[model samples]
Target: MTTMEPQGGFSYSEADFRRVQDIARREAGINLPISKRSLVFSRVSRRIRATGRASFRDYLDYVSGREGQDELKELICVLTTNVTQFFREKSHFEHLEAHVLPQLGEKLRAGGRGRLWSAACSTGQEPWSMAMSVMAELPDALRMDLKILATDINHAVVETGRIGQYPAEEVRSVPQRWQDAYMEPMEMEQVSMAREIRRLVTFRPLNLNREWPFKGQFDVIFCRNVVIYFDDETRNALWKRLADRLVPGGFLYVGHSERVDCIRECHLEAVAPTIYMKKG
Candidate 1:
């Protein structure tokens, strides 16, 4: 048995940090600046302890070696933040209710299917909110050809979204109307999203840097607060892909702090703050 060198039990070196950063960017298009070194160390340290590794160097080698594909994904999941709640950004949902839903409803009523995508939908809140807003506007949305595809790169958070249950405090911010219409009381101060609303959303695991499998385009896409972790080039590429995935006149909502300024080839025109419309 090889005796491991302990630099304060769970030592993290600059080399190990750089290696992790490189793998993360190459695999998931996430750019980790030097300021995030502490955050990365804290998160990856937990995984290192969980995996019973002696040092960060050993753990990094294991994850970077041949059999580390799924482990690499697990590492990404640990580092990726999923801080989200129901209607975290109210104006976007309001926009959905006022503009997007009406257009989708008209299409559905006119015998056409409608689709909404909640890309990087952390823990189901965003998609569920979209579903609730849509149902509130169009009572017959489920009966009509309507679907909400909610996807995230993290498998754990994707499972959380699929379950459609949340802590009561986590859901307290939900609007009363939506709470009454779409939530059922769960034990221990928890709430489960109504079955019908859950049915409206289909949860899937998606990595934004990878090629998307589906052929259909979306009438509305809410990909908020995700691209802030990417470099300029990666962010522009992602915006292009998102623009391509949207219907010609479809709506795109992003994070308040994030901007999509210069993807000229994507033909996205800013219509409002943090909102863009795909141009023909």
Candidate 2:
């Protein structure tokens, strides 16, 4: 393979790029095509510099070795995008308020348990928004047997969610009514979620590619926008796994651009755009 001469103090070759594609797929279920070659180079190049590796090959070798487990986590973090905000994809939240929450409210009020999972929750906004939605519909949710589980592959972002603090500007996207009820002002132009809201959510590190630790199912799951990184096989398998984790009549919300291709096989039916319900 002809190696391209050093573009930014490191020689990157076609073989190196293929290796990256394979490692990303195997480690994180991310599929990188040839178009992402430049992106891979740009992002992974920083790792080469940070780790003092002389070339792309050297950095790749080090990260592939047993001693590179920690760096491997960093590579996955750098490769995956984590852009999210409060009530993003407003339509999903709207549907949750208009339809899903009502059903869940009844179940919780009747002394039944309820669970909501933000499976790809980034920086806590998704689950916090979920908490706000629950509070709006069911003020006594904190007293009920209901909880929201927020998890992500990135440790740093999970910590951010656990802390329940965000830049003031970021919280501005939250509805003013909920904001006043659930947000507390802090110094340094930051805002903290009130203990009431924070208490409703649990943040932890989770990789969707791996086996889940918990065995229980969910009433509603928000797993939007993350599966686009995966290839067809991995994406389909993930969809099935997520479906298996949904209780009958539960809802699965995905990104606008994604579709649940295995709906029939998974016993799910499309209820709305980007929304599917597990059939009883």
Candidate 3:
């Protein structure tokens, strides 16, 4: 068997680098070719050093084995970038409040089930924003049945989302009216998501690169600012997979800077300003 050595007081064998790069490509469609080797090391090497493995091979072996898959996933979450904030994309929230929720609520009141999904929802801000929009459109008593699902690859973020508390600065940009209506000003000086918004969202761990785990269908799917990391094949596959969970003619929202040039065949329409709707 061929053997390798470490460097930089931490030997990173060539094969070990290849394996981790493959893992990122397979899991998130993020191709970490030679140019991104440094980025990979920046994200994962600290953990390898912490494990005292002294070799990337041993680290890879531990992270890739069946019993170690969870560890691998955790590593991916840590290495991946996740930046989120309340109302980060203001127009989308306004679209939901002014246009989407009213229409979806009418259908739900007519005995149709209604749900919104924030796929690739990094740190819970987007889905919570959806929840607030939904609640704002519906009267308080009639809001009990509506729910929004928020999912991300990171288990840690999912857990943090459920707690619905954040540093005050993280929520400062939220409109003052929304802040007053949907957040509890805590004595601890942090902002807590009000029960109205909190109860409306269901946070779950999801690997968007894998099969999505939700049951039934959703009225809308907001998958913004995520497809850029994925390759063309993976992005198309995800589009099809996500469509499987949406009602016909329901809305699908993608990030502004991301789009497939040939998505017309998917029966989607460039409806509204930045939203696409599946054709019936």
Candidate 4:
């Protein structure tokens, strides 16, 4: 068996990662650390080798403009590995059930609307699962009319997410009830999310690294599993930005491996093993 090389001892220099990191920061406000020297090189070194460039610097200059944007998208596609599954973090969903939804339901019932933002939705699963969780706890009236905004940097993935199709493996661990409620079986070893669930989510192209216009505040924002890709400054800045848009007493669900400690305003309350909410 051929083993992959360790993600260090990069062929490229730190300058290479810095250039890519600059692109990410300027575009999505995400920054990569110097420690990921190999990760940076591995993700982009092939581009250098493929183009037959003498150095990473030359290759970077080659990708400086319009064509560069295309290359940039390709880089992010490789570097931003958003590995997620439906109900992957079960406790957060449970906390949403046991605490959040009921109160949010009251707000919605009293002519208030509730909306959710899945900021880094990779392939529609997380946001779709969130919609299912909403439907599971919400009554017919509320569940029938829900709004979720799920955005991603990759336009292709964002478009795919809007279509609400996924391979069967993505939903393997999803509870049978929510799966039945949200997914309609299809041929080709896949399933199409039910129209009701699809209707609730709005998938859009958002460059989180760029200026974000807030149409409204969100009751919950799930930025889960994506922050580990960013540098400390970008992480802290993004956390602050997300906190600003989150409704007080609203929830912020991050990845099992990610933390929000640097941001002083929100206290991490461990309602679930991988789940956290903004302190009230």
Off by over 4 Å in 4: 1-18, 31-59, 141-145, 266-280
Write candidate 1's Cα lDDT for 1-280 as tens digits: 3322234367667777788889889988888888888788878888888888777888888898888777888999987889988888798988889988888888899999898999999899999988889889999987999999999999999999999999988888887878988999989999999988877999999999999989999999999999998998899989988998999889999999998977467888888899999997
- Using lDDT as the measure, the top candidate is 2
Residue-wise C-alpha lDDT for candidate 2, range 88-184, written one tens digit per residue = 9999999999999888989988999999999999888999998999999989998999999999998889999999999999888887888899999
Instruction: Write one digit per residue (lDDT tens) for candidate 4, span 58-154.
Output: 7678777665767766666656666777876777778777888898888887778788899999888888878888888884634434588999887
Candidate structures ordered by TM-score, highest first:
2, 1, 3, 4
**Which pairs clash (backbone N, Cα, C closer than 3 Å) in model 4?**
28-209, 29-209
Q: All models: lDDT?
A: 0.88, 0.91, 0.77, 0.75
- Candidate 3 has which clashing residue pairs, if any? 6-11, 7-11
Error of 2 at 143 (Å): 0.4
Residue 7 in candidate 1, Cα distance off native in Å: 8.0
Q: In model 2, what lDDT does residue 120 have?
A: 92
Question: What TM-score should be assigned to candidate 2?
Answer: 0.95
Cα TM-score per model: 0.95, 0.95, 0.90, 0.81
Which candidate, 1 or 3, would have the higher TM-score against the true structure? 1
> Which candidate, 2 or 4, would have the higher lDDT against the true structure?
2
- Model 3: how large is the Cα RMSD against the reference? 2.8
* Rank list by lDDT: 2, 1, 3, 4
Candidate 2: residue 76 Cα off by (Å): 0.7
